[model samples]
Target: MSQLDAIYQLHPKRYRDKIEEESNYASIENQKQAVLSIGSLGVAICSLIIFLIPYSTTIRGVIAALALPIVYFSFPYIAISVAAERRRKEMERVLPDALLLISTNIKSGTSINRAFLASSREEFGPLEDELRTTAIEISGGKSVQEALDNLRKRVNSGLFQDTLKVLSDAIESGGNTAELLESSAEDIRTSLELREEVKSSIRMYTIFIVMAAVFGAPILFSITVYMAETTTQMWSQTDLSGEASSFASGGSTGLSFEQPDVNTDFLVQFSILALTITNFFASLIISQISNGNMKEGAKYIPFTVSISVGLFLAVKTLLGSFL
Candidate 1:
């Protein structure tokens, strides 16, 4: 057995439906195995590099162990989710045109199967594949309702599923299929336009979230670190001068004070953790505002965290050089 088949056979039901729906052409098991294998390999390499860093052995070991498992599990899910979303978007974009075409063909006295076959154009992209598959299934002795229901099951979009249901009901009721399809097409188009308007209306909020996560937070943290470092240096100098004065005054000056040890490394590590967490949540919020799904925002986390950490380091370095 192939590696993918072996792995999938071990647990066939784990994410099987989602994997099948999201993967356009590849076998679901193969897609799952590819994602898991590549993700694990990449995470292992990164863990090795991290282990080589100057962190304490226990901290590095903990990070490596935690990060590897998290990445291994998360990468496959994220990959599949993203693929599903892209497929949904493509389907949505072409759905109106496909519906209109099918409706026009039906109006021209073409049967439902012929209408779907005629409407399955290359311009429809993924929707075309689904339409062609449905037509083929109907031609091969499958009932029209069963073929259409199967098509709906294969698609991940709620709008497309609803459209299929309306079409199926119209067909069953012997209603005006062409008119119902035309109406459904119009409604889908209107809904898509309204969603676009909503996204545009909330554009400013998205921008603000990105700015706060990537730039504002980093600058503030950099300034705090700079201030802490300056305070530590000042306190060290004060202690040295106070000791000198006390020694010069035959140890009677009484001006010595214990300096607090502010660990810069700890502060830097804390700042990184804080910024990562802050940007992760910020990305989720942005995703929710734009797409109404927080999981859709997970893809933005890496970019947000990378930019925030890079800006933090750059600002820290610039301030260190100047201050």
Candidate 2:
């Protein structure tokens, strides 16, 4: 066997099948290599940066070791999943149009396979490609049901798969396919419209949540952190040695003053960490509210985290400079 086939064989059947179904990667070996390359680069970069951290050598080494496998494996999966999601969205956007066109072709007396071919147009994008592929398979003497099933397997869309299953059942039962397609098309459009309406109704809530997470939380944390730093500074400069001497000498009233065991560095690090976590979850919540998919929130994560952390630091610096 060839080297690529040998490498492909190392994967379990289910993993290979999942990659094929969820991604547009034509070659499993190529995808595997791409993932390996991306992961290795990420690990190398992270390893170099980990040494520069102001942490103990043991802590830095531990972090670097843990990051190696995590970054190497997770980054490629994240990239591929994002691409698949974008493709699924594009397919969904064109699905209603493709169904209407297919129904129209059926009304004009074209066979089902021919109707699919007729509906395959550039405007339909990925769905058009799937339709043309299925039509070719049917023309090559493959069973229509098998060809349609293969088409569904190639797409990572639950709605598309469910629609195809319904169509397959209708075909097997000798139902009026054209009317079914038309009704399905109408239903899908209505569903999409209703989804949009729901999103619109919650628009204000989404905005408020985003503003609170990205703006209010950061500002509050910055102010709180600044106060903490100021308190620590003030305590550090205060002459507590006098109080210690007096107390040691058993002199006067029982009041004593000492610095609280507060680490300003730890507090600043904690504030940044809290802001990052808050922004991450806020992004996910916003995505779930607006797009109905939590995975879609990954696109917003960097923006939210960067803005929140940057704003916090900027505000803290401004407070330090002026006050």
Q: Compared with the true structure, what per-residue lDDT tens digits does model 1 show for residues 69-169?
A: 77766666676777677778888998998999999998999988889999999999878878988999999999889999998878778999999998888
Give the Å error, residue 80, model 2: 1.6
Write the residue-wise lDDT of candidate 2 on 1-323 in tens digits: 87757865775677656655545622133676666565677778768867766789899888877877787666666666667788888888889989999999999999989999999999887777789999999999998889989988777777788899999999989999999998888888887788789989999999999899999998999899899989988888999988778886896566777699788788788888899889999998998888877777877988999999999999999999999
TM-score, structure 2 vs. true:
0.87
Worst 10 residues of 2 by lDDT: 20-29
* lDDT (Cα atoms) of all candidates against the true structure: 0.84, 0.83
RMSD of each: 2.8, 3.0
